[model samples]
Target: MPVHNSDIAEAFRRLADLLEIEGGNQYRVRAYRNAAATVEGLPHDAARMIEQGADLSELPGIGEDLAGKIETLIETGELPLLEEVEGRVPEGLAEITHVSGIGPKRAWKLYEELGIETIEALRKAAEAGEIRDIEGFGEKTEQNIIDALGRFEGGEKRLRLMDAEHIAEPLLDYVREIDGVKQAIIAGSYRRQKETVGDLDILVTAKRGSDVMDRFVKYDEVDEVVSKGETRSTVVLQSGFHVDLRVVAEVSYGAALFYFTGSKAHNIVVRKRAIDRGWKLNEYGLFEDNERIAGKTEEEVYEKLDLPFIPPLLRENRGEIEAAENGELPDLVQLDDIRGDLHCHTKWSDGKFTLREMAEAAKDKGYAFLGITDHSKSQTVAGGLSEDGLAKQIDEIDELNEELDGIRLLKGSEVDILENGKLDFSDNILAQLDYVICAIHGGFNLSREKQTERVLRAMDNKHFNILAHATGRLINERAPYEIDLDRIMTEAEDRGCFLELNAHPNRLDIDDARCKMARDMGLMVPIGTDAHSINGLETMRFGVAQAGRGWLEAKDVLNTRAPDELLKLMRR
Candidate 1:
């Protein structure tokens, strides 16, 4: 029943969507959306902060009014404003807005014109060719909606890794505390650090007569107990996320973990290797002529298969088994390998923290340096710096650098790559910065060729150091903008430019596959947190996990180098 940051963020997002559909003020709607982002990015639970007597208003984008509302939500399990807005907006209208190519305003227009408030109603209208008659919505828009609906309906609902973490970690802690439980760990895709997970698989080791299953089914957050047994149980949490728990004896613990924590394809290939050796392998143990040989640990199982232990992140059957056999498996990047974050923001832009605070936070995290890449002039909504403003910031950074110790702040701008492939700032202004991080802030619907050309042209500039986000994706909320990433990687390699693995949970852009592509193309991938606040810096671990999954080693990441070396590498 604890109110997590994700829950608060979801409430704010729902309220914003409903208010937008109800024709609310633009700034007010934006405030809620930004608040949702801030809340979602927070590393700690808002309810726990309040419990510890911390002021919620101190959080970025959270004002006195928003903080009071958060308190109401945490204390009363409801947000009064959200409840009020939900009453004013047609419930289905908010859902309709979730469809791609449809915004709240479009949803409202659809409702006003055709009385279409539900997705099914909209689908009926689109299929019948009635939607194309709407003034602004033409045949193309109608067809796009039908296609979008097909995808929307067919796709399974899965939680983003971070949201699932917020739910699963607490449940994990609960299970680990059970009296007779000796071990508890989340397995499957969560173990492999995938961006999104369908369900949680928990494996536990417990003593005989342990009541682990009984206690797991009675957990506070469980909405329903789907099935329960002595060794295994399945439950659904209040958020509609499902979990399965299995209890195993200590002897078979590792084998159970190995089987359950699987990319099924990886397991299949390994099992085939065992079969070729005239042995059988499964959840309980590896067998030779019905005599148990090895299964006491995952290492034992791997050793018996004549393979080195494969990291969970590389268990996607993506050449990892072959690499392990040949001893060519990468050492893989770890969270500790990161020395600094190359992309973050300050109060100079839309970020909540000042330069000094962010630098100190970086120092606190043991980073040797932190890049302060505030927004360029084009992102006015994010308080993007004007030419004069950027000049002032560059000067301020020089002065702060002189006063600061232990950590260096690299001067930079997240310069927008304009639709026509022009940098937002002139080269003269860009020359003043230590480095540049170019990104696309708009024009997500550009054709693939145009998008690729835009990025390529931007990289042609000498000041371009890193391609931020690379693909402008927002996990489940938005698809990656169309572009030939292989060509982009090739161009980046040729141009001495790097691609970013933006670590922000919502925008783990340039996803795992692209990261691997960059690696194979000999491109250095910098894992930038795109941090807007101090707490936002904690997302670095998620980025590292993603990089590991992509087979990146320490040498493959840009920020893994020392301050001087990283700066040298950034120099074109």
Candidate 2:
């Protein structure tokens, strides 16, 4: 059982949750949480780093004490501290905290008052009308618990796209190394870049006697082999993630890849087109009567159908086929098209790096500019800066810019939108920065009408340049707060304010569907990483993938502009 970075991160996260539910020291709980984020964000495997004698303590937020624990876990495949905490705390209580509207404190309170320690027990209590009798809980809270439980169960069954990548990339590399293997790729929803994936579909082209399937099942992570055949196999990984692999001949490789990498709806429409043209299409090839006509490549198949190649990201049957026919397909935004990032944090707020370090990282990425949008005074938990603190940061940024070269830093603040629709900072304070990214950190339970109006009123301010994570959703963890996005987008367009496609994997807010809506309305969407550390900056690629799925071109993004042009656009 090899320990991957994700494994270490998950262990740390679980330990933190259990400790918090058991009333551990606040700083101790925070250390584990921060360590989890650091390990998870690393581009390379932590276990390998330890093998190479690298000092984990050198990583941001990972102290000498924490580094020792990581090495111990890597060497022994277990963390004694985590085991110790688990022995004292009901492990199920950690899982209960994951439910929407429930935190560690609330979970602990439930356990104390109702003797509920697991989701099932909590559900039973809620259904029996026992939860409302608790001091802080009432009928609405109890009902919300039942609704959130449904979502929690469904979300637990799927893996986030980022997590899937962590598992698939290593496996794909292992498969490609097998004797006689030719080409290998993980298809299905993973290839389409969906926010979540149910399972992985891998396609390969190999020589006649390739031992691909035989070796695939023996990979280091395989926990169970469900089935095995000459050219196909199924296995479940140690992480409980399922994977399927299929091998095909050279001629059918493209067709197999196309068939496996699909939105079912998109595949159905394409198959219909083939049927109407007196041709048959399947995993093997496209056949006309008894002769094969296309399928050596996806482009070849599309060409035979009188259409151009549709990128996998756009193969959702969402006007893509018609667009290809009318020659109106967009040149989707690529990672290279971005000139800068307009939403990031530094140590002034809940970030891991200093301004100079973050700027150097941006310069390394070839970015022309980087925006420093620290939290406003309202986000105290995140060490939000007061008005004077923000003023000092503005000065520090000016000083750093004068000394730095190639990367210009844009001073900005991620101000909070209050429950009554007022910006956290007044106009006097906001006008001092290069831009403002207003967001909602609390009040997620507001009515849809109020939520929409709260955002609409915030946009009325001249300083509101962008709405951060427009929906306040945390993917599987929390559903988006109720709001009429159609009305909000229209209001933003009228006000000349942009909406963010937050690139954080946990909150790919303003998801693909909304991205398309903004595109249709001719609104520019900035792909902000909402990065908290230098490693966090790498999430820009995910945003680009989402943007491509939404049919956006380089011109449809705000940060694609050069520094001067971007500054001009920022001014209302």
Model 1, 433-480: lDDT tens digits are 989999998876667899999999999899999999987777776667
Please write out the lDDT profile of model 2 over residues 426-449, one tens digit for every residue.
Answer: 899898999999999988777789
Q: C-alpha displacement of 368 in model 1, angstroms?
A: 0.8
Residue ranges of candidate 2 with Cα displaced over 4 Å: 138-155
Q: After superposition, how far is residue 47 of candidate 1 from its true place, in Å?
A: 2.6
Each candidate's TM vs. the true structure? 0.95, 0.96
- Best by the TM-score measure: 2
